[model samples]
Target: MLDLRDHFFVPDAPAVELRAFTHGLMPKTVPAMMERFVEDWRERGVDAWNEVPNHWRPGSGEVVGWWTLPETLGDAFIAPLLGAPAGTCIMQPNVHWTVQCLLSAPEPFTAGRNEIVFSEGAFPSVQHSVYQWAAMQGLRPRPLPLGADGFVHVDAVLDAISDRTAWVFLSHVGFTTGEKLPDAALHAVAEKAHRHDALFCIDGYHATGSVAVDVEALGADVYVGGLLKEACGSTGNSYLYVRDGLTLTPRLSGWFADADPFGFQKQPQPHPDVRRRFLAGTTAIASLYHAVEGLRLLLDAGLENVRTDSLAKTALAIEQAEAAGLTLQSPREAERRGAMVILAVKDAAALCEWLKTQGVFTDSRQNRVLRLAPFVWNTTADIERTFAVLEDGLKTNAHQHVVAPASAGPVT
Candidate 1:
C-alpha cells in the first residue's frame, strides 16, 4: 500500500494498521480543533455550543453548535469557498438533497414553467433526478453535450438558453477526463443565464478542495461539494452554498428549515431569511463534526499553498508520464487543469492491473485514460515511484506487443 501517513494522521504503515478501517480512524487532534471552533462560534455571539430546545436537537454527543450536520459544517467549510465572507448562507448536503429541497417549495417556490439546463457529464443522479422532477412538473430539462476533450462548449450552452430557462447547472470539473472548465468562461455563461433570469448552479464536488475556489468571485448562485474527495473525509454528507438574499422555498420541506419547527401550527410560518431556510431536517452530527475538523486543517494550510503544491505535483506527474511515452489526456496548460493528471494509453485495463501489482494506485476511465491524483498528502517521492512503476509496465507491455503483433490486436 502507498505511504499515506503524511496525508492521514496514522503514524503506522497503512498495511499493518488493523485497529480499524481507514475511515474509522479520527484525526488525533480533532477534539482540540473542534473546541477552538466552538470558542470561535461563541465569540461571534451565535452560542452554537449551548443546548437549545428539544426540537432544535440535531443529535447526541458533544454538540458542535446545534448539531454538526451539513448545514453547520457547511457554514464552517464555506469560509474557504466564499473567501470567509460574513453573513453568507452555506447549505451543506448532497446534490440530491439540494434537488429535494428545491422541489419541495410552496407557492412562491413553484416550479411552474421553469427550465434547468445541465451538461450530460455531470453527476448522473443529480442530472437525471432534476430532469425527471422537472418533466413531471411540465418543465423542460435541457441536456448539452460536452466536447470529446470533456469540456462543455460554452457557446453551445449559451445557445441552449431561452426566455424560460430558470437555472443552468454544470460541474466545474469533468469527472471522466479530469478536465477543468475555465472558471471565467463558465462565469460568463452564468452571466448570460442571469440575463435571461436563470440561476447558475455548479457542482463543485471535483473542483472544491482539489482546486482553489471563491463562490463569490465566480458569481455562481449555488455551489455543491462533499468532503470525501477534496477535504478527505467520509462520504454521503456534502455542502451547498446559496448566495445571500437569494430565497427559494425548499421542495423537501423538513423540520430544520421551518421558521419555527417547534411551533405546533398546522402550516409552517414564513421561512427564515437566513441560510437555515435551505436546510431540511436534522444535520448529520458525526460527519459534520469530523468534516469541520477536516476543513480547519485545509484552511490552516491555506488554499493558495494547496493550489501551488497541487500544480507542482501535477506538472511533475505529467512530465514523467510523457517521458514514459504516455499520451497526455488532460490539458497541458496548468491554468486550464485541475489537480488530476490523466494519461491516454492503448491497453488501459492491462496497464491498470500491472500498476496495481506494482503497488501503484490509479483510476482508469472508460475510454483509455489513466488518472493520477496526488493530493496534499502525496509527496514528490510518491509521484516518482508511481511513474517508475508506470514506465516498467509500459515497457513490459510494449515488449509483449512487439513479440506477438497478430495476437496483440489493435491498440484500444
Candidate 2:
C-alpha cells in the first residue's frame, strides 16, 4: 500500500490527516526551493530579481518572450495544467487583489454593463469582496440561490444572467460541499454570459490543484486561483488567467505594471499584452519560488494521478461515513465530487473537537457539516480511523448534535 502521509511533514504523523483542503501539508520540495531562493538572495542581492534564472522558454504559447523581459513571473507552470494559453496567466498576491484588478479593467463594466452575478456558495472572503465590489460599482450583486440539495444548479445560475450583467463569477468548486461544477455546466455558464456580453471568471482556489481543469474547454474568460490550499504552496502566489487577445487596461497601476518596467519611465504605458497594467509592485520572490516548486512537484507526480487518488480518498471518506451512519451533504457521483466530503450532523464543532482529541484532523462548516477532506497524504486506514472516532464521538451525550436525522442519503 502506497501511503502518501509519509511524504509530508505532518506534526502528528500516525494521526489521521484529513485537513489538506484547508492547509495542504507542505511537500519536501517547498523547503528545498525556499532554501535555494534564500541562497539566491544572499548571493545575488538586489540584482537577483532579474538575474535569478527564469524557467520559461521564449515563444512557448500564444505569446512568447516573457522570460526575456525585465520583470517576469514563472507561475506559468500552471497554465498548461489549467489549459490556459501562454502569456495569459499572471500570478498575483491574493484573490482580493486579483478580483479588484479584473473588475477595475477598463473594458469591463462599461456601456450599461453594471451587474455582477455569483452564487452564494462562493468562499466567504470572495463572496464578501464581490458584494463590496457591487456596492463600490453602485450596483447590487445578484447571487443565485443554493439548490434544494444545498448545491449549485447550473440551470438556475444561467437563468439569473441578464444583458445588464457585467461579470459572471463563481467558485470552480463549492467550498462548503466540495461539489465541482462539471465542464458542460461551466461551458453553459460561459456561453450564457457571452450571450449577455458579460465576462466569465472562475475562482479556482479550491479547484486548481485538486481538480483536473481545462479552461478552454470550460470556456472561462478569466480564471483566478492560488496555491495556498490544495496546491501545497504558501500564500503570496495567486494567479489570474485571462483568455488570449482580450484587452483590458488595468486601472490599478504601479511601476511594475509598466510596459518597460526597468526603464523608470514616469509616464506608465502598460504592457500591451495580458501582463499589461497588472502587477502590485515587487513580487515576493521567495513566495513565488515556493509556489512554482509546489506546482513542479504536482506536475512531476502528475495531476491526473493526484486527481485519481483524490477521488478515491473522497469516495472512501463517503463510504466510511455512510457505513458509520453519517449523512452525506456532498454529492455521491464520483464525477461531481471534489477532494472533500461534507457530512451533515447536528454538532459539527463537537465532532471536530472530539476528532482533534483523537489525533484526527477535520474542519466544520456552518456549525453542522463535518468537512472531511483526505488528500494524497492520507491512507484508507486514516479514513477508517476517522469514521471509528466519529462513531465513538457520536455515542457520547456531550458530543451529540441537536438531533441528527435518522440515517439519510445525500443532502437531496
The candidate that wins on lDDT is 2
lDDT of each: 0.63, 0.75
- Please name the candidate that would achieve the greatest TM-score relative to the true structure: 2
Give the TM-score comparing model 2 with the true structure, all chains together: 0.89
Give TM per candidate: 0.80, 0.89
Q: At residue 398, what lDDT does model 2 achieve?
A: 48
Q: For model 2, how does the per-residue alpha-carbon lDDT over 74-154 read when each residue is reduced to its tens digit?
A: 235767669776787876778888787777775867788788888989876567777776777686588888898888978
Model 1 Cα shift for residue 273 (angstroms): 3.7
Clashing pairs for predicted structure model 2, backbone only: none
What tens-digit string does per-residue lDDT give for candidate 1 at 271-373?
Answer: 6654566666665443454564444556667777777877887888888888888888777887778777778887676676566555565656663767777
Q: In angstroms, give how far residue 364 of model 2 lies from its true place.
A: 1.5
